[model samples]
Target chain A: MADEPRKIAFICSKGNLDMAYPALIMGWAALGNGVDVTIFFTFWGLDLINKARVDHLEIPPVANTSMKMSMMGIPGNLGIPNIMGVLPGMTAFATALMKKKMNELGVPPVREYIQMLADAGAKLYACKMTVDMMGLKKEDFLDGVQDIVTASDFIDMTEGAQIIFI
Target chain B: MPTRTYAGKTVEVNEEGFMLNPADWTKEIAVEIAKEEGIETLTEAHWKVIDFCRQAGLASGKAPTLRTITTGAGVPTKELFTLFPKGPAKKVARIAGLGKPEGCV
Candidate 1:
């Protein structure tokens, strides 16, 4: 147990409501185990750090084969049909259902999770190329973001650390 | 399933040194365990967190996670890191004579 503390770096490339949690949950767990955690948000993943979108992330059911009715405690193994998912309010409905389940399980929302991770000292970085391409400034991100760094810089920073791309 | 002496009282502990039976814990045992964890002194702050963990663990049937500790015990996350160092959730569980916290944050 006295050996060097392990380090883990998570590359977040997706920004859906469901996609945002894997890194946050895993990073929090790693920090609890005394592992150093670093997260890099690139492309759509940058929306997780965008203050405007962080709290509004939605889970569209169109391509989500796992969005089954059983998740809502319905008595069937039926998945939400892609045709039904294309309705005007389907995305909102699905997002709300997921949020309800997460709340029932005592899971923190994405914004709060980011705050918790930052307070616990996990390093958060935004991908610079994405930031520039999206015309986003540092102020567009949440306070937890440490900096906007290039992908090469991220590699150099996480040298010898276990990397997980999600 | 190993027995060890803490403050001269025999208690069962796991391989990771977490007390197997929380009923066998006492303030003296906590002190000795804290020493082994390199915490020479169990400050008032430490005891507050420990007391919360024990009660919460009993109610939940599992050790409290770091988020539970901070929100339920009224200790901030930064302060918990400072108080228990390295791994606060794991260390606090071991010293409080509770099982390790589940890994799903």
Candidate 2:
């Protein structure tokens, strides 16, 4: 008897534009490998699935170390002064630059990326706790979400599967 | 110093059996490689995927992630698993004569 294919679970807790891609890309790859893949979006990460707002996720440059360095055209390891990250329009500029680069690399924007993941058969979920806290309904999420599940339920479902927190 | 002879050609392969030089691949080599992976026969569906992967690798200069094959090749995810079984990406890459896809795949 052959064993079942491997499983992979992704937990995404942050909502920044940069924080979102890692989980999405990995989930897609897991599906490619014929692995069972599940992703739970909690708290701010919930933004990745919210039907009304998921597409509008932003890149805030304030207090962002990498964005600051990139804005100054310096090596990523070099940090810019704190005052620079606080400048008005810095967030917009940072967001625009990152968006541009992703476009050039043929990476889909947020909405399409989620669609692709769903198309590839990766399961998406929303945190029930966050949903109640935010007074959100299931309808608030996009079409691909499997369900809004509690943390405990998610843990149980992912048993025996490799879990990755992003 | 490792090699595998397929289709009467002895070619360099890695420990995992992927061809060290993708250019060494041919249709006969694909048939031989598929058999070595426990697929006794490569069906049309399998060739569809292998052909897509080879073309994508040639265009991109790297192996296409599973995502690309599903979206670009139009093979649904479920069918991909059925065609290649476990370790689909690695298996397809090996048979298609491309490098292993990086990251989770």
Candidate 3:
């Protein structure tokens, strides 16, 4: 091991079901490499730490241009038309399909990932400005959240660390 | 690939020192690898994780990820960290004579 452990910090600003996994997966991998991990959740990303919203996150297909028919097990290079994405229950369908695929690969749910990261010593923080803007209290966040911190505080805390903004 | 001696037995290992062949593993080799990872003593708890990882890794042809070890081996994530500090998944795999776990979680 190096004299000082490598440090990587992720700034999560989105909260879609698909968007949430990138930081979690990368952070877990970093931990396996003995790197220090810190994650800051701001804006819509605060939903990840919110007790009421974390598990119930939905992946809205609308405006998600990358969504393809192949993701739904259809054989084609065709993309799902944004027109169809606006239909009722499309978000639910998309979220369910993604969750099923993840489960089949033995991937844990979002809440479990958060718990696992916490147990493995990753530092999780909710953005204080977002929390205040949304009128959320500390109790509204998950158990793993260390604290609600300002953007400046997060910058100071992650000095000299590789930063990934998502 | 590189070969290193552990417990007087030469075995193939990767550049990072993880065993390339799970069949070449032994209890003595595990103890020696544990020492190299800064764990001087292998407690019963440590052996439980090691045994589970070895069996699971051999059965699956790949080492188990941290989540698999916790759920499949019935070890708590935090306890696994205490049993094998720094990086439990990688450290346990190295000591258990298994390939490095390839999963992200």
Candidate 4:
């Protein structure tokens, strides 16, 4: 009889197209390490799992790069358009770079990573406020999103869990 | 206090212990300062601009132009936009430690 795993949660609050990776990476990492992980997608962070938005998800170098730089010293105002992320070759290049980095570091792709966490019994929740603001219905998100929740519900559920805001 | 060459500028660690002076600094300078402040292990792309900002300063009195920095760093101009959301190159270059390029306020 092994002890139960400790739980962790990633609160994805960044709705920016480029800021989506941290939450996914952290959640996936927790799962890989055998932690019981949960992701609470709130506000713009819900865009990553949004069905309509997911297909169009592009990692615009301009905005994405600026966001990363912001963590270093760059201001958010200097970022470029997320639309530039859609440039066919551009998107591929960015994705390749990120994927390569992740692979080298033994991380999984976003889709597979999320699935792995889910399979390990990690929960994923979408904020009800985001769903409403985006004019989305419960059915609009991916299949694995466990349930819709208010922030309070999420906070309660995440009690005793190490939480990260991405 | 830790010290590092940011965009070729010797940015001294501030009282707050952040690497660069936060008073209107560019993203590039900010990153280097962050590194000096112990945010080591920067991603390659970040290294790219920091390197470029340094190289450009070495070559000329001013920071490289946007085109030059982008070309030098081998990063797309669009990507540079993300690193520096400010309207022009000088602002970012300044923060990067180039001390503001020409034609910048």
Task: Give the docking tier of candidate 3.
Answer: medium
Off by over 4 Å in 1: none
Taking the tens digit of each residue's C-alpha lDDT, what string does model 4 give over A1-166? 2565677889888755457777775554454334677899888777767777664555547445443434324666555456765566865566555556655655444555455445445689999888888788879877778889998999899888888888
| Best-performing candidate as measured by TM-score | 3
Please give, for residues B11-53, the per-residue lDDT of candidate 4 as tens digits.
5554433334433345656665545534454566656776777
Q: Which is the winner by lDDT between candidate 3 and candidate 4? A: 3
lDDT string for model 1 (A100-126, tens) is 989878899999999999988899999
Q: TM-score, chain A, per candidate?
A: 0.97, 0.90, 0.97, 0.70
Residues A34-112 of candidate 2: C-alpha lDDT, one tens digit per residue: 6888899999999999988787777886676654465446656667556876788766777788888887676778888
Cα deviation at A74, candidate 3, in Å, is 1.5
Q: Which ten contiguous residues of candidate 1 chain A have the minimum total lDDT?
A: A1-10
Ranked by TM-score from best down, the candidates are 3, 1, 2, 4
Tell me which residue pairs clash in candidate 2: none
- Per-prediction DockQ: 0.79, 0.44, 0.75, 0.01
The TM-score obtained for chain B by all candidates, in the order given, is 0.96, 0.93, 0.96, 0.53
True contacts kept of 3: 0.64
Q: How accurate locally, in lDDT, is each candidate?
A: 0.92, 0.83, 0.92, 0.61
Candidate 1: lDDT over CA atoms?
Answer: 0.92
Each candidate's fnat: 0.70, 0.58, 0.64, 0.00
Give me the displacement of residue B74 in model 3, in angstroms: 0.6
Candidate 4 shows a clash count of: 12
In candidate 1, position B63 carries an lDDT of: 94
Q: For candidate 2, give the DockQ.
A: 0.44
